[model samples]
Target: MDGSVMQDTDLAVLLHQVQHRTASPEIVSSDCSASPPAVLPKRVAAAFASTDGDSDSGGDSLLRPKKLRKPTDSGGDSLLRPKKLRKPTYAARKEEIAALLEEHRLLQARLELLRQNVGIPTSYDHDTLEAAQRQQRAMEEALRLQQFALGNTQSLFSKHMNALEPNPLKTYIHLTTDAVERRNTLLSIRREKLHRCYQFVHERLHHIPETSPYHVEERYVNAKGDRIISRFERLLFPGVQDVKQVFNALLFYLTNMEISISETLGHVTVRDDIDAVETRVSNHRVVSSTSYGIELELNAVHCYEYYEKFEEMGGQEFAME
Candidate 1:
């Protein structure tokens, strides 16, 4: 029995030591790098801790809230997407639209004013006005036709003059002799005719004083001793008396004539040769005849077929009364 009591006391001492260790809090070092970690009581460890709601019991609290990683751009697909357009505000363009509307109103008012100002006569009968306009147009057309007829009459004279122009090639072809030789002979004859005409005029002015209208004085006194000055005074009509002037007048008169004394006397080859004595004198004869009141007679057969046709076509309007 004594031996049993000593064993029970020993057992009670071991139970008390265990209770004391459990009751006292363990002093664990936070610096666990230098010393080994103090052993924890395996009885009240993680296995016994609640894992359902307590966030501080495990390493869950230390983990950061993972930022949601943005989706990466897959290649050119992002660039190909159409950009969304921003909505436009009506307030921003309201003033411009108002200005346009105001302009339209002003334009409408101007158009109305213009329409009122142009006062067209609406009282006249349309057919009467049309007939009056037609009569006025006909009168205007008649006046235009009269003016055209007058213009054509004036142009007819010019056309006749143009027809009288000589062709040099035709004249050359007509001459049988060398053109240069004929020209030289014609020039000599012209010079002689001009000298003779000048002498005749000079003699007539001094010798035949009664026939000539001009009276010439042979003697005149000036600062220098007695000058033999030919002072010619015209007692009749005013006329050119110069040799060159008289020569031109004679040629103009004789150029179109069929017969003349100069032509009969002059041994001329080409009819176009104005320097021939016949041509020069023929022109002079015409002038002399015209001056002496000789009437030019015209004797020709009448063929009025073309003239009748011309008169039918309104040419009678251009005829002199």
Candidate 2:
């Protein structure tokens, strides 16, 4: 009878300990039952309840399923989430620019071919057309000023040339079909040469490894073993600027020369129909493949030399049309 009473006392103590351990604020709400908690097995709860107060005694080692951590929790689980992929802005821009540059080159080639075949080139870009028109206007103004200055000098050549056009409209009406055809032929030749020179420059730029920093780094070496960041910038930036200046000068002078020569021929024609024939005879200028004569007359001294250098480098020779 005594042993049974002691056993009953031990069972009650075990139940009390388990109830105390499992009584978290979450589990001990008013709605929770006073009976064994639903999460724990009845046998496991009974076992833990019989243990001493010391946590190291392992009475709480029941294998209840672990609750998954919330995403907001500061735990290693958050680190395992996949990060979003970033956009490749640099690569995307590089490709876009390369495509645009290629398109520009193709358009330039097509324009040249059209100019050669039909004597008229098509331009799609507004800025390009505007720039060409502006350049032509400036050339015309310069030619007019030059004629004015020449007239003031009262030179024999200038006097006779001006004497031809007593009535500008009548002179225009008297222009023979042959003279018109000759002028058109000369203009076509000049346009073809200028276009070829421009194409040479453009293709030269595209071929130059030094123009790009990435290409420069690959091929060029600094023998002094110094750092090359500054050198690379110097090689590409100022060099490109110089090339651009050369290109602009070429276009300006070539256009000016073409306009001036054509204007002179027109004035000479107005003076006497036979003067065009005489001028052609005295000049004895057959349309030579060499642009040296025209280039020299305009004092674009470096133009042909620069073209030759690029031609050699690119292994491309310009053929006269």
* Best candidate (score: lDDT): 2
Deviation from native of the Cα of residue 149 in model 2, angstroms: 19
Question: How displaced is residue 128 in candidate 2, in Å?
Answer: 18
TM-scores of all candidate predictions against the true structure: 0.18, 0.17
lDDT per residue as tens, model 2, 7-124: 7676667666655745454554553324455565565455554442433354433422346876665555558767788779998899999999999999988877777688664554
Write down the lDDT that model 2 would get.
0.47
**Candidate 2 at 155: error in angstroms?**
15
Worst 10 residues of 1 by lDDT: 299-308
lDDT of 1 at 189: 47
| Predicted candidate 1 versus true structure: per-residue lDDT over 259-284, tens digit per residue | 45336533221233223333322211
**Residue runs of model 1 more than 4 Å from their true location after superposition:** 1-176, 210-249, 259-321
lDDT of candidate 1 at residue 182, scale 0 to 100: 50
